[model samples]
Target: MGSRLRIVLGQLNLLVGDVPGNAAKIISNALRARDELKAHVVVFPELALTGYPPEDLLLRPDLTVRVELALGEMLREISGIDVIVGYPKRQYGKLFNAASLLRDGKVAATYFKHRLPNYGVFDEKRYFVEGTNPCVIDLQGVPTGITLCEDVWEQGPVEQAQNAGAKLMINLNASPFHKNKGKERFDVVARRARANGVPIVYLNLVGGQDELVFDGDSFVVDGRGEMTQRTPAFVEGLYLVEVDADGQVTPITGPIMPELSEEESVYTALVLGVRDYIGKNGFAGAVIGLSGGIDSALTLCLAVDAIGASRVEAVMMPSQYTAAMSLEDARFQATTLGVKYSFIPIDPMFESFLGALKEEFKGMEPDTTEENIQARIRGTLLMAISNKTRKMVLTTGNKSEMSVGYATLYGDMAGGFAAIKDVPKTLVYRLAEYRNKIKPVIPRRVFERPPSAELAPDQQDTDSLPPYSVLDPILERYVELDQSTDDIIAAGFDEAIVRRVLRMVERNEYKRRQAAPGVRITPRAFGRDRRYPITSGYGAETKNEPGGNGPAGGI
Candidate 1:
């Protein structure tokens, strides 16, 4: 290159299925890079035109036509700077995940994603055929190679590009966020860069689609496997990086955004996930049942931070058994945050339902059925408000509760979005504390008080389940890590508690199936990440040896 190619990294947040809108974004960002940044080239995230994981929308033939038109718009409208953007392409009656390079108003080169990932949330193999060739093109006298997200995760694609005499590589991605996901991506990409001895430009899409949230921690790794530039996570902007013709990525022209702490990163991911889901779905605002517990408290903070307090509504539905402290905290939090707040007692509704069922239950003893009735009363009221006000209801249940069926289906689980469905109970407290550190919105008493559902008089969570300090770890092993009951007991948990927890998890698959989709902060979220049959008899407890202390049957 004459000097060095100043490449703009387009870390953008795109809505799925809006081809024209996404294309307009690609055009605007590309033009800004050329005119404002005075840049030679700009790289957009994978599937920028159609958004990532278009899922079965790729099955629509009209989507392909829309994509072609969008691609034409980018090629015609963006000039003076080369634009390499991703889209789904069709050739010979087969679909491929493709990236195209537009140079001088003509197609210069195109690279199909070689590796089709088919695990966890990705189902690329079902929709795309694997590509076989390596694409290396000359960019302003520099020999550059191209690859997609999963292509860089494995060893073969990078090797193929290097063997083809590529001096630099640009990999586009739509990788989603999970805990420690950034470090994992960095390790894998750095290893590939070092193995191939070529610098790489890593760009990712940032937004939320359903439960999946993409964190754009885009960076550049030098030839020796050192990351020179790292952009901020959960932010969208055009970042700049310089690449030399000598097969080296020079220092970034922009400032390196610092990496976030675990609490901060997860918190920000939840905020972004909530924001995009409401905005993309065109909801007027959000309505959350503020129960004065850790899950709901943290969710209230995230909602206010996400779409702003004006757009969020916190409703306190106090039942006859609801604690006085809970009512105090709920009102305090909503007032402190300045959201549209209201209160509706469920005693009258709960009593009417009970009166209707009294004659039929003459001999039956009152039990959890009554508790569920109260919950359903609250769910009905909040959903009614959501229907009339056009606000989406955000569920407050966490992963620990959902894993073992501590939640009531059609009752507490009734909502459009479950903001903290994938958050563990312990992490909920930590996140609540983290938000308090920023601004003391949640009261300290909410953290210090023993957790309770307050459905029954003096009811505590520990009365029906293990303490969360022990419960969360056992769940992390069994649910998230897929460990057997025996394996968990071997890891130092009590055998009976392990089996009971495992049984709850196995039996509750049906409940999780019906729960609303939420942000996935862990490796194995319930809906999309972990897929277990609800009707299976081979529960985790049965996986023990023939002479073991496993449970006899699932709950």
Candidate 2:
């Protein structure tokens, strides 16, 4: 048993469904760590072969075969250094999220993920069958305990490894990012390390896969539950961590990297999420309707930053109610950012729509119909540009608007990606400010102005909804915190406003379901994060029955 051992927690980024590409990444990183760093072994994240949560791609026979072949290739290529990698292993008509220990051009051992998180953003139960064994093997004569992502989180597998005389635990993960997710990981790893009386290497996959963004904050903790090294979030690279038999980890000295701030980390996560989504799907560019509002301005900035300014186009679709300052601000911001800007008035289109519906609405009062008509007209024009230019339309609705149905369906909600759909209005303003801090990209006037849709004359958002300062917190409590109407009201919110907001949220379930994929910064986003039935009688109306609505309320 050598006291000197090198382990590389290969926190690498993997593209979903790219079996060959992902396999190449795994082998490349392993070789780099083994040859260049002179590490004894390199470990990859959970399901690194087919990419984490291959979603429905696992159902394809050809894709599964491709993944299996790639896995075999990885196993056959590497020899000198042992490789601990995660991949899908098929056995007896069941798919297991398993990790393989490869040495001397063959798989030495394998371990399956035990805990399949079926709640919130996870759907592992729908895809994988759980495995019930602790994968403990010898690495350079040191006992190494292998556990897949979710397996390390629970007690049974890690405890079983300790009971089986394992000394070090290596957990491969493809964990997704959610605001303070890194902190959660640190806490969990610390607890596990302390309880197991052994060091743990927590490695994760980084990159954007659909709405989910995995932040590779791969870290190491000693037996005393002390963090030794950490890789930065929202980026990809080989993080080399050396562990001793005494259960201590120390960073292999090279380029000393500065860690990102919480705000910067989250901000970069959103940018990368959007960048990968656009780039991976092969969109020519992104088209966003810039209304000189905070949400649209922030979205435009992110779009330009994600892909170059040349790749982004900002269109101003002003209706009759649009203010002159708004149009100017929109133009100013777009030009300042070097993004292509275009203005298309919607009054003519509005008139045509009104004429078509004139007889039907002959005696009815003009209300949200006019507002929605303006939205639909803008949506149509954006879609037209998108269809012609092969650019993806970018929706700018934030979580605040999305939570209460403030956005118009098939109108402002029309896009291939909702860049800021998970961000709340208050955070939207903060992000706008954050963007401006680097360089004043968004016009100060845009932030100073009162928020409005400008769908109808003098239509301010505050006219129909509570102030975002008030609304966002309440929405966060109710939506993210899953607070009841009574709970929201107990938090000092007006009962009537809480009820109204909850009602709006419930009624708009259909719209949210149809909305495009968006970056999820919050714990619960509109996409896969929050799953609710569209055609449901279940509202705040059902009570304390776990997954049932307790009362009738709106948000």
Candidate 3:
């Protein structure tokens, strides 16, 4: 009873709705931990059985059948180690988020998650009911409490466990990534550990699930709120943690992994998100439409990093309007990255299109109608290549462009995945700089050049939209924060510009609804995270209510 406890933390990246595959991995990890690591108990993330956010898959009756089949296999195979894992449990004519202790070939103790999160990418309340009691299990001599993701955010579950005389707490999570979420999570867990005088072992699932990427910064904290071990973010592995229990309190100790910087973390999230989305969906490779601008250039780097330069292809479909510098820069990066590069001129095809439409449109000045034709031509070509090679088309549009009505729907936005859809224009430049720091792949002129779609003669993005420096903040306030028009104006933004930006965002709901899925690096992304009606006549708020200056950072 005076011996130390050795627990293996399984920070895994699991696919959604693959119940049998996930359970197999769980059993395999448990056996490995017992044999190689010599650990007594191995813990997994929340909903680890069927993967997190199973969504509507939870409604299928056959899902319960598959789960029971997986359970039967685990009971037959799992032994010599205690596997504390999470799964969706069906009981009493209801479903609850539940976890159980599989020790010595039996379910020793089970715990149900008391809190169900229902905001911003989580609809747990729709799928699961609230758990009332705490399930405390004895690992050797230590009484450990089990809680799911949202339970740690609130105080009640951990407090109830503490009242039940839990010496250690294990909180399983499928918490997704957003900007600076690592710090927010650590602060929350550390505070709870200190306040309740209970050591906490926090394990989170790591991988991209559609728009959400869970950065696995799993760690263990002492009763005094001091972290003893921490795993690196955006990685999948089995890490070991040791705790010495003296019946007074549990002291955690192990090797700690370093946390990533802001730019580093966001960039890594982009790479992981792209990789998993492609690999999980069974795409062969990634095909990016490379422009000489920073957005495409940065996206190219991400693709090469994500899959590899050999697997990535760069296509530069230049038009008469595309600048000479753009052509040079795009070609240079493609050669430098050593990817398959092609320069397919659109002049001949574009001319044919104009000739075909000549009778349909007479004496019409070359307007955006003509500009859009060029984009559509490029989109057509890229999609054609994607169809032939099975390489998914990766779009180059950023959040700011997508936020407003700046992006062409069937044109530039035509791709399988948008790596930086949640990233703003300002952040795009920063990521370009971040990538170049490792090795200067993107040309200097690419960053310095004025951003344009290159679909028209002598064009610039600023001609149609505000400067990203100012535009990004306004979009963040209006789109992500839901700040009223008056509130944004009060916080040092021009009223007219604010109103115009609001209108653009509101009018473009239909476009965003059809946009491709991308990584969510911000608190609120376009799809799944932020849902707004496309046909709503609900006007943008212009309330005069006093809400002072919004905090001046998120860029």
lDDT (0 to 1) per candidate: 0.89, 0.83, 0.88
Off by over 4 Å in 1: 246-254, 540-555
Instruction: For candidate 1, write residues 1-555 as lDDT tens digits.
Output: 436878899999998999999999889999999999988889999999999889999999999999998988877898899999999999989999999899988888989899999999999999999999999977777778899999998888888988898888999999999999999999999999888778888999899989999999999988778888898899999998877654454544456678899999999999999999999999999999989888889989999999999999999989878888899999999999999889888888888998999898899998788888878888888899999999999999999989988888888899999999999999999998889999999989999999998899899899878999999999999878888777899999998788777777777888899999999999999988899998775864444634233211111
Each candidate's number of clashing pairs is 0, 17, 0
What is the lDDT, from 0 to 100, of the residue 148 in candidate 2? Answer: 76
lDDT per residue, candidate 3, 500-545, as tens digits?
6777777778888988999999999999889999877676352222
Error at 235, model 1, angstroms: 0.2
Worst 10 residues of 1 by lDDT: 546-555
Q: Candidate 3 local accuracy as lDDT?
A: 0.88
RMSD of each: 2.8, 3.7, 4.2
- Native-referenced Cα lDDT, model 2: 0.83
lDDT of 2 by residue, 301-345 (tens): 899889999989999988778899999899999999998999888
What TM-score should be assigned to candidate 3?
0.96
> Is 1 or 2 the stronger prediction by TM-score?
1
lDDT of 1 at 191: 93
TM-score for each of the candidates: 0.96, 0.94, 0.96
- How many pairs in model 2 have backbone atoms within 3 A of each other, for residues 3 or more apart or on separate chains, i.e. clashes? 17
